[model samples]
Target: MNLVENLVVFAHGKESGPWGTKITHLAETARGRGFEVMSPDYSHTHDPRERVAQLLALAPTAKRLVLVGSSMGGYVSAQACATLKPQALFLMAPALYFTGWDEEPQGVPALCSVVHGWHDDIVPMERGLRFAKSNHATLHVLNSDHGLNDQLAALALLFGDFLDQVKTEIL
Candidate 1:
């Protein structure tokens, strides 16, 4: 019997690239936990729906799937979850319920976690809270900004713990 390896796909923010600082760090953490990782580049379009389509098309099938997103990418990941049906989701400062996006974010993975910055100027903390509350996702509100660049180390630790929990649950 062929066993498909676990997969982790990362969706970068509107302004960040696929291998930005946070993604690079968290990808390493995921890798250390024996999971395959991929970050699709959505730099071509600023449209969230387009980004979601790109993710849906590119994400490969795996025995266990984990989707991670930041800022607008978080919205893309959540939207893709409707079709992908990933096992887990990790979002950082996700841009949900913002202007210009017509559809409300949907799809709830079995395990969902969010890390939001209290000082986020781009996406308000309240928006993150609302998303977390509605989805019943684990939330971590940090003392940082929208980028959460200053909390990279803490993010790595949190992501590692999250991945461990996912591993345990899937087993």
Candidate 2:
């Protein structure tokens, strides 16, 4: 298959920087697959609005963009990409009902998939379900908690599958 000129950006979860396990793993995977990756460090700002601005600033306008956001970062990615319109969005345990963000989540005009842990206590899977439904996204429910650390291998596999799907459908 021809490799598309794609840029993958990973938005880390709240309290986690850009070098966390998820971000690192996915970045490596994307790189190994011949895709450029960016995991921006938003540790300086916890405010969702500020994060959205930061993420948007890093988004590339010249290439096909794929965004992967986790937890609060997922919220940032969702809001930032609403108008940016990337090729695909992969959200893991997105915090949708947080303060300073939109009360009602809007649909992203791109192929989007949401992966949430069923046992998540911090953000809860229900919020993911609601967001996915509202945005017409595919929701993947896993057997883990908010951090989803216990299921890294599975998450990586699912992410690989997502990239493959994007390769076929969007790239």
- What tens-digit string does per-residue lDDT give for candidate 2 at 1-171? 454487788889889999898788878777766678888889998887788899777655535678889999998888877666788889999998866675764547458899899899999799999988888889989999998888888878887787777778864
Clashes of each: 0, 0
**Backbone clashes in model 1, listed as residue pairs:** none
Query: Model 2, stretches more than 4 Å misplaced?
Result: 1-4, 105-107
What TM-score against the true fold does each predicted structure earn?
0.95, 0.90
Q: Give the local distance difference test score of model 1.
A: 0.89
Identify the leading candidate in terms of lDDT.
1
Top model number, TM-score: 1
Off by over 4 Å in 1: 1-3
Q: Quantify all predictions' global Cα lDDT against the true fold.
A: 0.89, 0.82
Model 1 superposed RMSD (Cα): 1.5
What is the alpha-carbon lDDT of model 2 when measured against the actual structure? 0.82
